[model samples]
Target chain A: MGQVVVVTSGKGGVGKTTTTANVGLALGMFGQRVCLIDTDIGLRNLDLALGLDERVVYDLIDVCSGVCRLQQALLRDKHIETVYLLPAAQTKAKTDITPEQMRTLLEQLKPSFDFILLDSPAGIEQGFQNAIAGADWAIVVTNPEPAAVRDADRVIGLLHGAGLTDVRLILNRLRTQRLDARSTGNGTAGLGEIEEVVDQLAVDLLGVVPEDERVVDSNLQKEPLVLHQQDRAGQAYREIARRMLGESIPLMELTPPKPFWRRLGLRFGHHARVERK
Target chain B: MGHRDPSLTRKWGQGGKRRAMAYLPSHIRVKGSRDGLTFYFDGNVAMEVWLAELQQLLQREHHLFQGPAVPVRICFGRVPLGTEEAAIRACFASHPNLIVHRVEASSTSITSRTGEKERTAPTLLWGPVRSGAEIQSDGALIVAGDVHSGARLVAKGTILVFGILRGMACAGSDGDIEAIIAAWELACPVVEIASRRKSFEKLSAGPTLVRLEGEELVTAPARHLKRGQGGREQPWAKWWS
Candidate 1:
């Protein structure tokens, strides 16, 4: 059976859906049959984020309610042939989907896909429970802020209580430049701040995505960043995908802040000018 | 070939079962009843050696007394159970003691002993504790994670939680009155420490600590307690309730 991975974060807006989109795309690029299920129900965004909003004819609710077949609801990604999107019903509330229903749907989808990625809704409500019902593993998305970490810890505790211990942490939106600058200001608090989280949660550090404009740019373009070959953030997503597939991709070397002119060249998409500069 | 002795005839025909071989030191005394077994060891016997002798004696007559129906009680003058709880429990779960049903302690310091002296370093388990996860630790119980709602944690000593405690936590289960259960969040009201439970309606939020006071498990505020002052001075240090 395929592995069911639920992307969850107790605190909202910590990149749960974004991680689902990118990781799903990255896995698909790695030649895995990936099906991304948006379990947010009423507040669906995975289809939009993956640029498959218009292509969604049937949704998870349709399949769960027996109105449509599983094959009819899966929206195959135009770019990645192996990737499919199962959108949530924007008209139904979180309670519209029960945990048992989700579990049944996941079991049905298990044979057809290599990975089932559930984009869990924010909060620990029915939607979150539904998303995690049949998940073999979970990826808890948390930012660098203490509030985010605390909520992530709560989610970790809940998942652990649920007997889901294969949880990994994906530290998102960590502005290393800011952390470095803060470290330079004070003598010791620089790395200590980041290391404390890893120590407390006691989980594998899956991957870190630098707080870069490319992430937002790719999102605005309605394309997963991992699809962009040149974006550094996209490269981070690709590395996480590779690691998930049991590949040992070396951590990408950070691109040091370029000179003002070089940054301008990079911003303008002129690689030759930046090289010469 | 003369199987004429009443005791020998009784053993040969009655499944070869023998009576529980009792051990009584000359200087001290012991008493047995349907409820429990009590040993009054003189304060003179060193705890370790006396316990070792007691276990060796039990091992010698293994087949006769296999499983006892009543709890075994080891009474002492000022001298406590010779071994630390871990060692004592191992000895008790040995051959003879297994036949005995439950183990009971009625010493004057049974409460204090159960908390500090008897309790060994708890076997800390860190993982998703699912339902039917049976963890019986003689020492203090430290679940470095949350206990699922249906999971049960039965510890002879204290139950310390570095995470949420939604499961049932039975602390002081081995008759330790001083064993306190401290959890980051105590929502489980069905907690029983030494046979005392507070309903879920009575459970409070935030950091909580529950202990047995006067044969009752009372929920109290848990503080970032320092070591060695005992539970008295740190009483009500910080109230999460």
Candidate 2:
């Protein structure tokens, strides 16, 4: 049976859907049959991220309402044969799917895939509860902000309360948020801030996604970040996916690489100092 | 209810009754009940003068007031005792006798203001006491894990945490001035004890204890609290039983 993972964060705009799309694609690259379920309901965006919005014929609601079978509702991405996108209904509200219904649907789809990633909606509402109903593990995606970390703690607490023991954290937008001196507390966080949050939440760190404009560009271009090879954020997502599969991998170094001239100069200086020694 | 400085209450055995009954204030009426003395204050008198006369009464008739350990319960007749209640507690503090037990208003209950009628046994918990979670106890409360921010813990008696405390902890919620809150790590912004509260701007670096000392909240290192044979939880063992 496949392991179902829910990507969730309690607060809004912490990149739950984006992380879901990218991680799902990365899992697909590893030869796993990946299924993506967008449980955001009215705020559906997973199909657009996969560039398969036009190919969505039926959705989660239609399948739940018995209008179509689960396979008919599932949309396979054009470029990748291993991944499928189960779009959420744009017209329905978050209250549409009950937790029992979501759990039953996931149970039916478990035998067909190696990994199923449920893209949970933001907030600690019914949508989030329904999305995590059948999830064996949870991935909490958060920005390196106090508010986001606080929300992630709340979500972890809820998951623990529900007896879901395996929960991991993803620190996204690390060192990438623009610092604003005018604002009260909305600014770029440092390594110390990330350490404080990780300490406070007390969860296993999955991976860190640095602030990269390419990630935003990927969303705008209607393609998932994992589709773009050799990208920093894509590599982070890949690492997270591998970790989820129980592969041991060290985290990427967060510091940006130096420019070519600066690297060359430092190398030459180090070599001359070694020759003198 | 408490001994002011542990200085007296030994004088209760002497002949303390014959020399009293000189004068009793008009607004204040003292009655003997099955439990100890109950003082009823008329609401018409101003709060200051009422407290002053009560103080003078206890001062002049100090010999008559020294008796059993049952706390003296006061009833405020038909008036809202707001901040005036704290002033009343302050008055009781200097008596070297008499502790403020319960505040009885013509409006509120005589039993439970913040807790049940009687304080129960201490509650022991294994916890993160997660965000948005609330834990309340009639008696003392002990947690083996962290108390996260946005969480709340209120107890009628003392509260003890073996891990970090980053939430709101209110000890002495039922107005017991002797209650305390101690944690392995303290980051609580505000702490309330016996209806009095104090806020902190920074986190405490080590194990700390927050308690009430002479009508004010004071914090000190919890390591100073003696521990016995019970191991790491020894200090709180007495509170549990």
Number of the predicted model whose DockQ against the real structure is largest: 2
Over A175-235, each residue of candidate 1 has an lDDT whose tens digit, in order, gives: 7677656663322236655566665566777887767787778778898888889877778
The CAPRI category of model 2 is acceptable
TM-score of each: 0.58, 0.70
Candidate 2 ranges with C-alpha deviation above 4 Å: A176-191, A264-277, B1-121, B226-241
Candidate 2 per-residue C-alpha lDDT over A73-158 given as tens digits, one digit per residue, 9 for 90 to 100: 99997767899999999999988779999989999999999999999998898998898899999999998787888788889999
Question: DockQ of each candidate's interface versus the true one?
Answer: 0.04, 0.39
**Global lDDT scores for all candidate models:** 0.73, 0.79
True contacts kept of 1: 0.00
Superposition error at B97 for model 2 (Å)? 34
For model 1, how does the per-residue alpha-carbon lDDT over B31-103 read when each residue is reduced to its tens digit? 4443455444444546665566656555544554466554665544453343444455676675544433423
| Superposed Cα deviation of residue B27, candidate 2 (Å) | 45
Show how many residue pairs clash in every candidate, following the order shown.
8, 0
The DockQ of predicted model 2 stands at 0.39
**lDDT over C-alpha atoms for residue A173 of model 1:** 81
